[model samples]
Target: MKKEIVDPNYKGEVIKHDVAKYVPETEYVVKVLERHVEKAKHNLKGAPIVVAGGYGMGSKENFDLLFELAKELHAEVGASRAAVDAGFVDHDRQIGQTGVTVRPKVYIAFGISGQIQHLAGMQDSGIIISVNSDPEAPINAIADYVINGTVEEVLPKMIKYYKANNK
Candidate 1:
């Protein structure tokens, strides 16, 4: 790369690269290979209930509780990007700006701090329930019901209640 002064204010101290241009070596034809798409295990878009988890859920093992709760609640599972990044769940289950959007009858957020990106995904739910230890969590502002407790403490009880009370 060759360097040159770009601004009049800057002297020899300022150096810029001489842009390089290149031509494509070859043009290749792209082919559609079977046109197969990998769909999420559950159709979150149509689910009446959605149970979403976030970074605050702690570990991947903790995420399992969400699944148990979903089963009892007859809901689909979803994750925040934070949860996906932490390897707590699969990317396909992510629900946020960078993931899929859902407007279910009931949206349950567990341990989610309510990032704007995450909120953009599920803010339109018919009912929003947030379970977080912090009362001032942003998710709480939008939640129809705010349960002030950690996921580990709250999830099992919810699961048990649903299992016992479910007809």
Candidate 2:
């Protein structure tokens, strides 16, 4: 038996061979099936800035401070699973391995311990700012800037500074 290769774009030459002696034609039928698709609701996929709160926020009332800062910055609000489980925010706002991923220009984490699961989602952000009382928190390791203070103490000062400077 012998084999020959042909160029698909060679219009100047023609070659013929008998392939019926070694091969046979086969036909295939494809079946189309229908399935149901559910659309996901709106999320913070493209927000330029995001503020995420964690359990260290202390309570729902303390979490409200983050919202005030987010409002001032014109940023979207997010939360860790711990905050969502604690009913501080809705599940849609959760950010982690089990939540929506985000790549914002700036990610400000308040009271978050920076678990691996949470880091997986936002580690690619252009800048990461962490605020926590513990200096040894895991989130501090990846933070571009770390503020060692409680959210209530630090966030108010940050908001005041932003307001003072932006004006």
Candidate 3:
């Protein structure tokens, strides 16, 4: 029968065996494991609101204004590479091709020119509001709302409005 099964030319007789009779019966018990959730160390990643500053913000001292606005809006502060490179902000706060990526519900860019590298990190934001002095700035192109004014001028009014209405 083995020779008949192996030989292609052989007219073979078919046979069936009860393999189940020799097989062992086994049972499996599945246990659900509890999920371990870890707390995030960085507060910026999941921030609902983010306020990013760029080189156009002028000086490091100007970041105080940005921070004031961020406080009013309850937003995290982010910075472009230029701002970081200029020593205006810390490296961890930098957001761009070389920095941390963010997808905030509302991203308010102040003085950021919208360089491609910078845009890559933040373009996924749900709503983008850009405040820039230059009307032709690249950031304005992707902005849901573009405010054509210096951050110094625009931020204060915005902060005032939020405080007045949020109360």
Candidate 4:
């Protein structure tokens, strides 16, 4: 019996692109992740912070606000696939069924409408806090504390409060 040889150019063969355009160009993601890890190692950190699905965080610029808040709080930043897909965050910091599963001490949901898939990853967190303009947002249902307001407004106040009280 003769052995058959497979063609290298077979149509069924899968090929990956040389570069991925889907990845973000921002260097801040790396800086933020590294800084948070360093802070955690030094015990100069706050509770783990997972920012849920991106609903009101409409653009990458909006997501930067979350980074600012995280920096102020000295907390780790996490996000949902929607936020990554929308370029609000890098894929590396995603937290959901398709991403990293985090059980942060305080999971902050900012502008996240809370899809079930996203909630499955962080629902077991020690404390769940959500800030949304709509009180009826699904994320509010699972949150231990709900702040019905805009992230832009609430995050500053929150950062201030946590720093003052925790310190």
The TM-score values for the models, in the order shown, are 0.79, 0.73, 0.74, 0.65
Candidate 4 ranges beyond 4 A from true positions:
1-47, 51-53, 160-167
Could you tell me the lDDT of residue 13 within candidate 2? 50
**Candidate 2 lDDT, 53-137, residue by residue in tens:** 9999878887787778888888888999999999998899999899989999999999999999999889998899999999999
Among the numbered candidates, top TM-score falls to: 1
Structure candidate 2, residue pairs in collision: none
Model 3 lDDT tens row, 64-144: 888888888889999999999999988988997999999999999999999999998999999999999999999999999
Put down candidate 1 lDDT per residue, 17-116, tens digits, no spaces.
5544343334335556687778657788889999999999999998998989898988999999999999999998999899999999999999899999
Off by over 4 Å in 3: 1-42
Relative to the true structure, candidate 3 has a C-alpha RMSD (angstroms) of 15.7
TM-score for predicted model 3 compared with the true structure: 0.74
Candidate 1, overall lDDT?
0.91
In model 4, how large is the Cα lDDT of residue 156? 68
Summarize candidate 4's per-residue lDDT along 1-167 as a digit string, tens digits: 49989888877858796554666567345554343333333221234655553757677876776766677666777777887887877776777788767787888888888898888778889999988999999989998999898877887676677668766
